[model samples]
Target: MENIAGTKSSLSWAVHISVAALVLIWLFPTVGLFVSSFRTADQIATSGWWKAAFPSEQNLTLRTDPPSTQVQKGGQWVIEGNLFGDKRGATISVYGTSSREISTYKAGETGKFRNGATITVQPNGDYVASSDTKWKGGRGPRVFVTAVTPPEFTLRNYQMVLFDPANREGMARAFFNTLTVTIPATVIPILVAAFAAYALAWMDFPGRALLVAAVVGLLVVPLQLALIPLLSLHNDIGIGKGYLGVWLAHTGFGLPLAIYLLRNYMVGLPRDIIENARVDGATEFQIFTKIILPLSFPALASFAIFQFLWTWNDLLVALVFLIDSTGETTVMTKQIVELLGTRGGNWEILATSAFVSIAVPLMVFFAMQKYLVRGLLAGSVK
Candidate 1:
């Protein structure tokens, strides 16, 4: 007994360690995406998400110029223009003539030039200079700055990706489109397969083994092999490229697996209880409705979660059966793919999209996980 217990403990430890390693590996990119999603496009392009945790040194541009047509006052060049305009409280830590290398100067220090000109900059975009000199023909001198940015995060990216309609169609509508496809696609197969599974498992039937065999056979068939044929069929059946077509496609593809899974779970149900329902003069439908369904809740919930998540995150079927070139029929996955192509450098948008896509699946799993733990699987195994 002690030996068995020790072996069990070792096996459990190995499983736990393996799970931990898998979890970390899985989460690393997700965490990186999440961090990157909050970052600016430039910031994401230049540095990894880890660097965002600390202040980063970057070369940025700063400029000072006279207002358009500034009038001389008291024989002085009363030039005026906004330096670092609309930056929303950016402090000037440094400035330079060329963009290549920028350096900071003390607020009270003077920048002496080769032309006997002096430049002094204040913290508040104010500047003073004394020079017996004139700026070069029709252009002002260029400046560069190396500034330390504090940890600045913004919801603007999320708003832009999810809510801004005039700017673009955005992921919000595609998120809803995904639901439109996913909910029905997930539900139809399960609904149809539940009755089929119940019939095969508990009801007297003709060719039951053959039906099960067919479903199992489909498990090995690659979906890609059928995509073109399915699309041609859709074009023929008058459904064309739309919600109805994709829903039907998903339902067909999902049904075999659904029926197979539900049949295994339904077969494991207690025969005595089903027989007792028969003794109670219940029809097959009634037994299925009242006894089998209530008893098969765990398997149903588990399959629902699985199907819902798959259909929610699916892209290939959407590409083939649904009209995705235009933004109208795009799903979250499709929209995300487009965003990756056009705005790959935008980390925050990517993260926000990722989170939005999975939010519903996460909710369904959390809410239904209880069924897996404490429901019909208990009765089935025993």
Candidate 2:
């Protein structure tokens, strides 16, 4: 008995450890993308996301107030101001008047220049330079400062991707266009599949078995094979490359699986409830609307999540059927692909755009995961 109990405990620990490993593997890239989106372009390029919390030393060429802004105080020429302009706040480790001697003076120490001027810079970027002789020049003296800047983050990437109208490559229109494609594609299929599934599961009809077999057969067919033919058909039918065409394509491609899943799920629902509704003088439409629809929430939600994700993430279907040279109807996934071509070197922009594209699908999955699990479990019951 003790041996069996020990084995069971070991298996439980193994299962937990395996789950932890899988979760980490899945979350690692997403967490990296989320962290990268907040970082400046330089920060993302220089180090990994895990190192973002640590202070980083950077050599920066900064300028003091121009000689034109110098004031005469205490019978001496002076140039006084903060070196790190509105950096929020950063720590200066060392600084120097010449690039060759960038780290010559420690923070809070004074250094004498070749021109008989003394400059003092504090850790917080406040600096003072003074000379008995008047300073001359249109430009400020360049100071090389080695500073340990605090971990920096910015929302400018997301702002540009989402809201900056001036940015021609922004995803605002693409995002809405994706929504336009996804909502109707997701909803239309479920409604059509649910009604078909009800007829297959409950209503008496001929060739029902053959029809279900046909749906099962269609599931094995590759959607890729149909894309070209479907495009030709759409072009001929006056539905060339638009939301309506994409919606119809997604609905047709999705229906086989939808009908298969909903039929199997609805077939498992207790027939007694359906029979009771019939005895209560409920019409078939009323029974489906009031009884079966309420009972089929899990299946509906499951299929909705599936179809939503598929349509949202699909690039091939959208490319083949929807997007045009005008580029007005481009979706988020296409927008990301375009970013890869245009802003390939801009990691901050790429990461931010990718995350924005996936954010909605992730939210929908998390929100309906319970129903998804329920539907899968219920569908599994013979």
Candidate 2: the clashing residue pairs are none
Which candidate has the top score in TM-score?
2
Write candidate 2's Cα lDDT for 1-382 as tens digits.
5476456664788888999999999999889999999998878876778888897777788988889989999899999999987774778989998878999999999987877798999999999999999888887788888887789889999998899999888888888999999999999999999999999999998999999989888977898999889999999999999989999999999998789889988998998999998999999999999988889887898888888889999999999999988998999999999999999989899999898998998898888888767656644424
Residue range 1-382, candidate 1, lDDT tens digits = 5476456664777888999999999989777867776778766766677888776756566655643434455655444444555563445566655444456465435665455555676554455654443444444444555555555667777788788987573688888889899889988898899999998887767898998888788866889998999888988988888999999999998887778778888999989998988898998889888888888877787677777878888999998999645658988888888878987756667777877787777787688777545433532322
Q: What lDDT is reached at residue 250 by model 1? A: 90
Off by over 4 Å in 1: 1-23, 63-74, 78-93, 100-119, 122-142, 363-382
C-alpha RMSD of each candidate structure in angstroms: 4.9, 3.7
Q: How far is 234's C-alpha from truth in model 2 (Å)?
A: 1.4
